[model samples]
Target: MAKFSVSLKARLFLHDHGKLLLLKQTKPNGGNYSLIGGTIERKEFAIQTLIRESQEEAGIELSEDDLELVHVLHKRSAKEHRIVLYFRAYHYDGTPESKELEKFENVEWWSLKELPKNLTGTVRHVLKAYNAGLIYSHLRK
Candidate 1:
């Protein structure tokens, strides 16, 4: 078997007034909460993916300069391996409206201290890294 190359993902770390933005998943990858983002498209930079995904999933606009690369996580599971680029965003345009209704229930804000328990493993690891001020992490399943 050939070893596959690492895939790229873009994730948004959006927080405001002591709360973090999250999406309640629906199926296939449901029952777990996660930040708004997606797989990076071909020929697009991770930053571009961040901007695009934020708009697509959350109905908000983000700029390249408005996002800072805070963490780069190398995560591996039995079936998939990828590099998740986490961008810390301090500003966004308007509130996140409900999009991808079939994939996710709704986008909501949760206090850091009162976050939903069923967060995706990826999200949990990412958040933990953020809280710990880590710039990089390697998680394995």
Candidate 2:
């Protein structure tokens, strides 16, 4: 048996009506739409990470009471193994904008039924699972 390193991420599914909040990254960063979130820090919990990430990446403020854990994904890519926690929040403070200009270019709302063609693969998979009332899913690449 061998030991492996796994990264943990916390993502937000901030939505209203039938729309979701998504970020468009600069070309150097991937040039695709993705959720607002980041890696969980060494001393932070998933919820705490989401709270901090929401503020830093999108200028949206989230409280512990505003978030609900909607899905968990175990993803194994060629580069790394990761466990991502997706939180759904219909309530938050401040209008969402791209605060990290180096990584993201635009902050936009998209209809769930008409998602952009450039949406990230991971986001698409997670959203499908979440919408299907799944709490956990696995993906390998």
Candidate 3:
């Protein structure tokens, strides 16, 4: 049987200029850029997890009013299952920085039209979904 787990993720959209913020992880898994996100703690609501991760990973504080649920994607890896809750933030304070430098190298903003070509498959899928205006939750093989 496959091990199942719940992973919470949120993508930060900066303003209405069609730009997205991303972080480049360092060490262990360096040079890979991904959204600002992490796993959800047990018993934590998905929205709460989104807020927590934004603060932890990017130092951005998000409230319910500041975010809109985009989608929930079911992703499965070789060893674990993930329920990724994606969100779009229209309002926020503070700049994004690599608070966890030991694991995160840098944070930068990429225009939607100029996303890095080397994003992981999962990231690519999310971006495509967002661009296509299909934010509803879905299962991924």
Show where candidate 1 strays beyond 4 Å: none
Off by over 4 Å in 3: 1-16, 77-79, 136-141
lDDT of 2 by residue, 1-141 (tens): 556779999999999888999999999999999999999999999999999999999999999999999999999976678999999999999988999999999899999999999999999999898889999999997
TM-score for each of the candidates: 0.92, 0.95, 0.83
Arrange candidates by lDDT, highest first: which order? 2, 1, 3
lDDT of 1 by residue, 64-131 (tens): 88999999899887777899989988789978976887777789999989989898887888889888
TM-score ranking from best candidate downward: 2, 1, 3
Query: What is the alpha-carbon lDDT of model 1 when measured against the actual structure?
Result: 0.87
Clashing pairs in 1: none
**lDDT by residue for model 3 (1-141), tens:** 656755555455544467778888775885778887776677777678778878888888788888777766777666666777777887787888878787788888888888887666678887788778876545556
Which lDDT values do the candidates have, in the order given? 0.87, 0.93, 0.74
TM-score of candidate 2 to 2 decimals? 0.95
Clashes of each: 0, 0, 0
